[model samples]
Target chain A: SQKIEQNSEALNIQEGKTATLTCNYTNYSPAYLQWYRQDPGRGPVFLLLIRENEKEKRKERLKVTFDTTLKQSLFHITASQPADSATYLCALGHRDDKIIFGKGTRLHILP
Target chain B: DTAVSQTPKYLVTQMGNDKSIKCEQNLGHDTMYWYKQDSKKFLKIMFSYNNKELIINETVPNRFSPKSPDKAHLNLHINSLELGDSAVYFCASSQDLRAISYEQYFGPGTRLTVT
Candidate 1:
């Protein structure tokens, strides 16, 4: 069976600081990895997707790094703002399989 | 316009009853999906439809069925809902199943509560 894990504890950082979240997987070689943002009582919104061949991807203040050798992906939000507080999820997917999501890491930005 | 939408945003029903959640996507996507988020906030895929054809069905019970009238619509029908069935159901769609860059757009989600 394949399993994905993220930090279970809530990550708190001051505004304008960089916040890094980790996603680790075991027993699966995904073709692509994705990150999503989810607010309370709302569906997840796609943030970024990185292919197995790609090393890193960026969008605005968000950046995602994929290290297939380590079976991990790191999501970083630079100069974070209070409005950026939300749970971030990492997803793994192959060509023939549906995307699988991790439990997610809750990030809180303190002013 | 809302790219993806689901009807009956909030559903509260008793155990043993039956209900359905309707989903529609205006993005003209060829792949549609149904996902369930549990109390623990774990998101899991229940079903996936491509061009109105069933492509992926997870280890979901037979009590849960997904119907697609077309490429842009997918509806979920649950029979004999149990207390454990309470969760938020989300509908999503993507451009095509074979496209590697296909990114899913999600709806607001339907919160189902079985008392």
Candidate 2:
């Protein structure tokens, strides 16, 4: 079965520092990988999407890198703030209609 | 304006009861989906509909049924809910899943607790 795994433990970072999260998958080759931010009691909000061919994508202070050979994707939040604290999810998608999501990595930016 | 919205933000019911969660999207999207987030916060897709047509149905119990009356609306109804059914259900919509840029917009979610 296809499996997507994000950082299982919560991550704590100092304010204004960079926070890097990891997403690794096995048994599947996804066409695209996406990152989403989900606050408590709220639905996930799309952040970034990177295709298999794309090595890296950036948006403002957020950056995502996809390595199909490594079967891993890295999500980075630079100059993170307290407001940036949330559970970040990694999702994998194929050519089909469905996409699978990871359990998400809880991030806390401490002031 | 809310792009995706769900009715009954929180539902608390007993076992063997039947309940429904309603979802509506005002983004004029063509694809809508239902996902279940369990206690471990693992989000799993249950069903997906494109232009009011069922496209993806995952390995979920037969008690859970999804109904889409139109492209903008998808409702989930669970019959004879069990204790294991307690979780947060989310509704999401995208322009078109078949398209290369398939980023989903999700609703607030409905928390169902089977007591």
Which candidate has the highest lDDT of all?
2
Write one digit per residue (lDDT tens) for candidate 2, span A15-85. 99999999999999999999999999999999999999999999999999999999999999999999999
DockQ of 2: 0.74
Q: Write the per-residue lDDT of candidate 1 for residues B1-115, one digit (tens) a residue.
A: 9999999899999999999999999998999999999989889999999999998899999999999998989999999999999999999999888773577899999999999
Candidate 1: regions farther than 4 A off: none
Please tell me which predicted candidate would have the highest DockQ against the true structure. 2
What's the true lDDT of residue B72 in model 2? 91
In the order shown, the candidates' DockQ scores are 0.69, 0.74
Q: Would you give the TM-score of chain B in model 2?
A: 0.98
In candidate 2, which residue pairs get closer than 3 Å at backbone N, Cα or C atoms, i.e. clash? none
In model 2, which regions exceed 4 Å deviation? none
Per-residue lDDT of model 1, residues A1-111, tens digit only: 999999665899999999999999999999999999999988899999999999999999999999999999999999999999999999999886789999999999999
TM-score for each model = 0.98, 0.98
